[model samples]
Target: MTQPLPTRDTIVDFIEGIFLRRGAESYLGEAVSMAQHMLQAAACAERDGAPAAMVAAALLHDLGHYTNEMPDDVLMEGTNNYHEEAGANFLARFFPAEVVEPIRQHVATKRYLCAVDPAYFQRLSDASVYTLELQGGPMSGAEVAAFRANPYLEACVRVRHWDDEGKDPERAHPPFSHYRPLLASLVTS
Candidate 1:
């Protein structure tokens, strides 16, 4: 049988368990561990003075990597893990649209940036470059137009930037507990 869902009061603990258990894994061949990458992304959002919900989005953006059923080598083996959708859908259970939508759209935002700015493509790490192909490469003209129309476009882009910047292995951010209150504040009952 499936496990019971976390209630509003216990959701933070449930999420914290995820980080503690799955966060130590490699972040898709990035220099940092998964937890480090996510914490660092949240740090970037916090440093940039993003709204609390955006900061939460940046923190939890890659949660699908933890929640998905795919093996670690899924991307390397030529499969699209679709982590963005998995993560956003999971977060939708407990978060507002402002928080979940950015996570959902972050991968597309990467594609959007690649289509709009050639230089952005050069900045992606090797793994990201590989995944970009799996993610449908850059946006086509119509795709770009649809992406532009998303109300969360700017937020998605900002989260993408943080996702890129968050791979620095040496950078340190506060632990998950530091953001627990912020997360709790945004959790829907």
Candidate 2:
């Protein structure tokens, strides 16, 4: 009996709330904070001339990480919180499928990339590789084949690329307020 997030402003405020408080906190084991990572991703998407839907997805791709009260130490303790599913489910109530689907599949996109491209695995950061192992490692042949068949697979991969490259603590990017209009337009009643 889960409900989708409320109005677009509520949803946007929820995101802003997280960023205002926990934004400065370390992003799990990554160098940048959570807010920085998300901002970087969103900025990257915009720079690449992505659609508004995808830019929104990139901005909120890791919403799962904040959906619950789970301890951040869970990752250190070797736990997979499945934040992707949590985020997509929560966002589904307020956003179109285009925005939500990419968030849901970003993790799988990582595995899919790892499966199809050996070089891809080598490019991951140490923290990413660690989480990849915790996330069931690379995709198997069957998993890769199934992943390939998904229509939103490309979207997921695009977000994944931004997610991977968005971890720089020193990276310069605009503030979260820059995306407010984009997020507001996509918000449902």
lDDT of each: 0.86, 0.82
- The candidate scoring highest on lDDT is 1
Model 1, residue pairs in steric clash: none
Error of 2 at 148 (Å): 1.1
* Candidate 2: C-alpha RMSD after superposition: 4.8
Candidate 2, residues 1-189: lDDT per residue as tens digits? 122435555777767776787678788888998889999999999999999999999999987777543333332333345888777777777889889999988888998899899998999989999999878888999999898898888788898999898998888989988998898899877
Candidate 1: tens digits of C-alpha lDDT, residues 1-189: 123556678878878888898899998778999999999999999999999999999999998876543233333333344778777766787899999999988989999999999999999999999999988999999999988999988898898999999999889899999999999999987
- Looking at candidate 1, the ten consecutive residues that score lowest on lDDT are 69-78
Model 2 stretches astray by more than 4 angstroms = 1-5, 69-81
Question: What does each candidate score in C-alpha RMSD?
Answer: 4.5, 4.8
TM-score of candidate 2 versus the correct structure, residues matched by position: 0.88
